[model samples]
Target chain A: MKLTILGCYAATPRTFTNPTSQILDIKNRLFLIDCGEGTQVQLRKNKIRFSKINHIFISHLHGDHFFGLVGLVSTFTLLNRTTDLHIYGPKGIKEIIKLQLRLSNSRTNYGLFFHELESPESEIIFEDEKVLVKTIPLKHRVYTNGFLFQEKIGDRKLNLDAVQNYEIESCYYQKIKNGKDITLEDGRIIENDKLTFDPVPAKNYAFCSDTVYNEAMLPIIENVDILYHESTFLQSEGNLAKKTLHSTAKEAATIALKANAKQLILGHYSTRYESIELFKEEAETIFPEVLLADDGKSFEF
Target chain B: MKLTILGCYAATPRTFTNPTSQILDIKNRLFLIDCGEGTQVQLRKNKIRFSKINHIFISHLHGDHFFGLVGLVSTFTLLNRTTDLHIYGPKGIKEIIKLQLRLSNSRTNYGLFFHELESPESEIIFEDEKVLVKTIPLKHRVYTNGFLFQEKIGDRKLNLDAVQNYEIESCYYQKIKNGKDITLEDGRIIENDKLTFDPVPAKNYAFCSDTVYNEAMLPIIENVDILYHESTFLQSEGNLAKKTLHSTAKEAATIALKANAKQLILGHYSTRYESIELFKEEAETIFPEVLLADDGKSFEF
Candidate 1:
């Protein structure tokens, strides 16, 4: 799995800082998240293939989260895109996009499908053979949802030596790998656990942003491999953060700690701070494995 | 009058090039024209004060022309702007903006007034004491209008020696400046022209973009001091330009020549061209005094 941070600043985009956008590549699928303004330029600077983005997920109706969506859709039409583009966001997103397209008189050459999300509870929003995506309800000024992308558990690995010792036929190897007991020719049964070893554990990532410090999402994102939470302010500005319904670095760390996430990534920083290091310094106090999100940064697992 | 090119490239914004956007400073009023995506960042990079822009003129509803407007409006609200913002655009622009603002539940602290235009003929859209803005209808794939900014004639300057020779009171200077013939004590008439030369002939600028080779605007923009016309393609791609309803560099120069404009500025270049010098080379063929539009470049007239 790979993740690329296109932009991570909060409130407004500046010459050096962008608002909020990211690209996640999991199981050969490229998913775009929260396309703020100037996202297309960022994608060009990062040299990411624009055609690879098939799915887009938006957290809320804030301009910093979804303003770049219509531009991207229009650019897709200009580029003669033929692949169906799926967009998942809160209700009313479709109207905003359709209105702009109508005014411009642009008809997309590809199918633009919108899956409006309105559920207030945790639910699986997308699932396939390789991955599953679920919504993590978040508390914000507007209706918001954070997405949790998890890889599906794979098949068990067969122990060739153990299978050979048990005189198991080649045809039974598939059953053994599927965690099923194998029957031998002598009417003896070979246990699946004895012939096979467990596969690598599934890895999962959770993205939460533009929300206040809330513990309701702890159970839904429990033990996630990586957690990206918004830290719009430092610990010193906790009051402002609370007033704005945004989280401080310490608050994001507390949520990561409570959820037992392996790694915590902090982003969506307010431009008032001179340096991003302050966020890392504050988050690391509670979560040992903490990283600060920077524009154009990439992480692989 | 000063003009700053924030972005001039056509179609999608790239890492090195931007879409259509400009700042026209005339008569102490800063006017933003055609805010494409990334315009706010460009304004920041150009060091233009965002608060000074009270009026915005959108030439069309294409994404390359007005995609950055909503973000700018949202940023204004975030910055606590109280000055009323006036926007002039097509008939459907008001609905597009209001719907997005309504969906986000953002009520602007400042008033946002929209002036919709659907006239096929030229008409004055805005007029103040020092400036006048008129629409120049253009032929494009969409309903579009080009803006003509003209500086209103100012008070005539009184020749100090001539006024003193006539022993004119200071109170009467205002009337003389207003082009009134001052009555002499001996019943001898002093002509207004003898007192003051005509205030610098009112300078006018015509902005035409995303249009084809249309001569209908010649009379409206006749003898303009500066003319900015879109040249999306070169002469070799005349067929493409004709099909897209866009002008070639040659066609833009032809319009400037026919209009008898003092100077011609070419912009809205297609990304297919490797160098901008090609546009200048082609335009200068028809109009000798031609300049290429470049981002961050400023022109004073």
Candidate 2:
């Protein structure tokens, strides 16, 4: 899986800094997360194909998180997109986007679907044969939800040597790979474990942002291969972070450590901080594996 | 008058090209016209002060024309703006913006007002002591209106040499500048023309964009000091321009020539063209004094 950071800063978009937006590529599919203003331009700069984005997940209704969604939807119509597009966000998101489209008299040439979320519990929002996505309910000033993407384990691999030794027919390989025992015409049964090898482990990625230092989500994101958490402030601004319902670097690191996340990625930095390196310095004091996210940066795992 | 082209391209915004948006500084007041997506970043790149912009004029409800207004309004709140902001656009603009703000639960610290326009005929939309702005109704795919910015005629300038020669006291200088005849204590009357010189000729600028080659607005924009007209296509693609309800370079030049404009600025170019110089070449064949509007380029007249 690959994750591309289109924008990672907080608050207003500036000349050099952008608001929250990212692209996660897993199972050969692209999912856009939190499309902030100027996101289309950033998508162009990163050379990401616009048509590949089939699903978009918004964390909240803040302008910094989803203001660019309408522009992107309008641009898709101009580009003659014919594929269906799905959007998942808070309950009020549909009204915001539909109002703009209606006012502009713009009708999309493709099917547009909105799956508004108002639930406060963690539940699966998307699932397919290869992947599953669920929401991690978050605490914020407004209704918000973070998404968890998990890849399903593949079928066990066939051990050619073991199958040949057992004189298994090629037609019976399917059942062997499905962890079923093979039966011969002589009434002899061969164990499936002897004919197949273990499958590769599946990977899980959790995205959390715009939340405070709450441990309620720890159970949902425990042992995630990669965890992307918002660290909008530093340790020195802990009070301000609490007052604004945002998490500081130290608080994010503590959550990552308590959840036993394999690797922690820090993002959604407040523009008031001059250097993002300070966040790494603070996070490393608690969590040994920490990564900083910046605009146009990418990571592969 | 100084006009800054924040974005002059047509259609979707790209990494190197932007959509429709510009800043017109007339009579020491900044008037934002047609705020497309990514306008706030462009404003910062152009070094424009956010506080000075009290008024915004949108030509139409097209995404490329007014998609950036919501983000700009949200940014104003983050910046703690306390001044009133006025927006003049087509009918339904208020509903579009208010819906987004309501969904996000964001309220501006400053006053926000919208003046919706649905009239097909030309009329005055904004007027102050120093400037007057009127709508230049244009024919487009949607209900569109360009803007005409005119500097109101100022009081006569005081001729210091003449005033000193007449030994006029400073107390009567205000009356002299107001073009009033001076009456001395000895009952001598001096002509106003002899005591003051004519003020600099008030300049007028017309912004016409996203419209076809229609001549209905020629009377309103005649003798304009500077005219910025949209030339979305070259002569080779004039058929497409006609079908899209956009103006060709040659067609725009014809309008400028017929209107007797002093200088013609061409912008809102379609990205299909390889070079913008071809537009100037096509326009110069019909009219002289043609200038090309590029992103980040400024024009003074």
Candidate 3:
């Protein structure tokens, strides 16, 4: 899985930065995450294939988060897209998109589906053969959800040395890779573990933003392979973060540490801060595996 | 009054150019006309004062016409605007904005008023002491209205020669300028026209885009000071223009000439055209005063 940061600023679009928007590549599927205003332009700037996006997960309804959604949907219609698209967001998203479509008299040719989250409960909204997506109920000024993406268990890997040592027939290698115990022509039974290796552990990505530090979510996001938490302010501006229902670099790192995430990506910095080096330094004190998200930067997981 | 063209391309937001968005400065009012996807950046590039624009006039629901509106409004709120802002557009515009606000759970401290147009009739939507705005009924794919902004009739101007040579008293000059016959201190009665000239002919500016060449509007826009009409295609693409309910450059020029406008400003070029010089050249064949609408270029009326 790879993650692309299109924009990561908080309140409004700045001269040098953009509002919230990101694209994540998981299991060969493109998932647009938290689309904000100017998202299409960001997509173009980052060279992301716009039509390949099959699923969109919106964190909340803040103008900074989903205002670009209507325009994007409309652009899709204009571009004559026919692929099915799914949107997972809060309840009001349907009304917003529908109203714009109604006003414009636009009927999208593609099959557009909406899965709105109403309850603050952890519920899986999407599941395919390769991945599963669940919502992370968050505490915010409004009803908002963070998302967790977990890759499905992959196919087992065949152990060449072990298979040869066990004298397994070549025709039985496929069965062994499928984690099955197989019998050879000599009436010798080869155990699954001896003939095959365990599949790699599934990778997980958790996205949490526009929320205060809630230790309650630690269990939900625990052991995530990669975690992206919005650190809107620096540690010195902790009071401002509290006032705005945002998190500081230290708090984001604390969440990452408590969740046992292998790596933490901190972003959504307030426009007040000139440089992000201080944020990385502060977060490193609590979690050493920390990186800052910059616009157009891509992370492969 | 002055008009600045921010962008006019039809379909997509390009790296070198942009989609539909323009600025009209009338006296003290700065009106944003048809905001497309990258209007904020366009405004920044043009060095236009974003906050000074208190009113946005959207011609229709087409994404090419007004896709950037929500972003601009959100930027205003983030900028901590305290003045009331007004939006005029098609019927569904209010709900589109309100639903986004509801989802984000954000309410503005200042008033956000929407004057949604529903009836397909020409009517005055905005008026002040200096300017009067009336909608021009148009035929399009969706419910749309072109705007006609006319400067209000002002107090009569004092004929300098008559005021000085006729020895008119300063106190009586005011009455004569009001188009009333006045008596001088010498007991001589003077006709209103003899003492004062007519007030500056109310400058009228008609703006129309995203509409076909509907000659029905000639009466409303006849003999205007300036006319801005969409030139989405050249004559070679006339068939496409008809299919899309758009106008060619020659068609736009014909409408301008028929309306007896002083000058014709053409924009909203189709992406197929590499350069807009052909548009100007075609338009000038019918109306020699035609000018291409380049982004950031300003026209004084």
Candidate 4:
């Protein structure tokens, strides 16, 4: 899976800085997360096709997190998009979007679906044959949830020599690759494990943003391959974080460390901090495997 | 009065190209016109303060015309702006904005006023002592109107030579400048022209965009100092202009010529034409005083 950081700045969008927006390319789909303002322009700059974005996941109703969504949806209509669009966010998303479309006299030719997420527990919001996604309920001023996208383990590769000696039918060989043993034509029993190699390990990506320091999410996103969490402040501004219910860099790292994530990506920096170096330094104190998220940056795992 | 071109490109926004958005800096107030997508970014790049712009005028409901409005308004709230914000646009602007705010639960901290315009006839929408603005009804796919911003005639400047001869009270000097003859204490009648210089001719700006060739507005916008009209296509793409209800370069110049404006500023160009020489070439054929408008390029008249 490849994750493209379309925008990572925190709070308001500035000339040089952008707000939260990310694109995850997994299972042949581009999942947009938290479309801040200028997301369409960012997508254009990254040379990503607008139609590729089939699903959108918004963490909360914060302006910085989802202000770009309406414009994107409008542009989709302008471009005459026909594919269905799915959006998962807080309960009020549908009414808001419908109102704008109503006022503008704009009706989409494509099917638009909304899945209002109000569950406070870890629940699967989306699932397919290759991937499963669950929300990690977060603590914030408003209702918010982080997503844990997990790629399921695939079918194991077969040992050609074992399959040939077993003389199994080709159709039965397919079952063996799925970790199932089948009886041979000569009545010789062959175990699936000896004939097949282990399947590729599932890779997991956890996205947590616009939230306070909450260890409750660790149980759901525990030991993910990569974790992206909001770092809205530094330790020096810890009091401000508490007042706003936003997490500081140190707090984000603490959660990442406790979750035992392989790598931690810190983003959603406050507008007050001009440079992200302070965020990286603060996060590294507790979580040494910290990486600063930058707009237009990409990572692969 | 100064007109700053914040963004003047047509079609979709790119890193280097932007949609239509301009700032008219007249006296104490900053007025915004036609905010397309990425307008806030364009404003930031131009180093314009958000607080300074409390009044925004939108010509239509097209995505390329007012898509950036909601984001800019939201950004103001995020920045904790408490000043009153006013918007004047076509009907449905309030619903579009209110829906977004409702969905995100992002409401203004200060006063928010909306003056929706649904009248098909030209009318005075804004008036102050120093400025008077009216709509120039236009024909397009959607109900649309172009704005005409004009500076009202101001008080004349005193002629120091004439003032030395007359024992004029300083407070009454303003009345004399307003073209009223004032009698001096010594029983001498001072002609208004003798005591004061002629008031500076009122300056005016007319905006005509996204419209087909129509001469009906020529009389209303006649003798304006400067006129910025859309020239979306060159003579080569004039056929497209007819179907789209947009103007060609020649068509815009014809309107300028008929209006008898001091200067014609042509923009809203379709990106298909790589070179602007054709636009200038076509417009100058009819009106030699025509000027091509560029992105972030401003002109003074």
DockQ, every prediction = 0.85, 0.83, 0.63, 0.56
How many residue pairs clash in each candidate at the backbone level?
A: 0, 0, 0, 0
Ordered list by lDDT, greatest first: 1, 2, 3, 4
Which ten-residue region of model 1 chain B has the weakest summed lDDT? B193-202
Name the best candidate (by DockQ): 1
Across A93-112, the per-residue lDDT of candidate 4 in tens digits comes to 88777866666567778899
Please report the candidate that would top TM-score against the real structure.
Answer: 2
TM-score of chain A of 1: 0.94
C-alpha lDDT (0 to 100) for residue B80 of candidate 1: 93
Q: Please tell me the TM-score of chain B in candidate 1 relative to the true structure's chain B.
A: 0.96
Query: Which residue pairs in candidate 3 have backbone atoms (N, alpha carbon, C) closer than 3 angstroms, thus clashing?
Result: none
Q: What lDDT does the true structure give each of the candidates?
A: 0.94, 0.94, 0.87, 0.86
Candidate 1 lDDT tens digits, A82-151: 9999999999999999999988998899999999999999888889988899999999989999999999
The CAPRI classification for model 1 reads as: high
- lDDT per residue for candidate 1 within B1-301, as digits (tens), equals 9999999999998998989999999999999999999999999999999999999999999999999999999999998999999999999998988999998888788999999999999899999999999999999999999999999999999898999999989999999999999889999999999998789778999999989999999999999999999999999999999999999999999999999999999999999998999999999989998999999999999
Q: How accurate is candidate 1 locally (lDDT)?
A: 0.94
How well does candidate 3 reproduce the true complex, by DockQ? 0.63
- Which of 1 and 2 is ahead in DockQ? 1
- Worst 10 contiguous positions by lDDT, candidate 2 chain A: A97-106
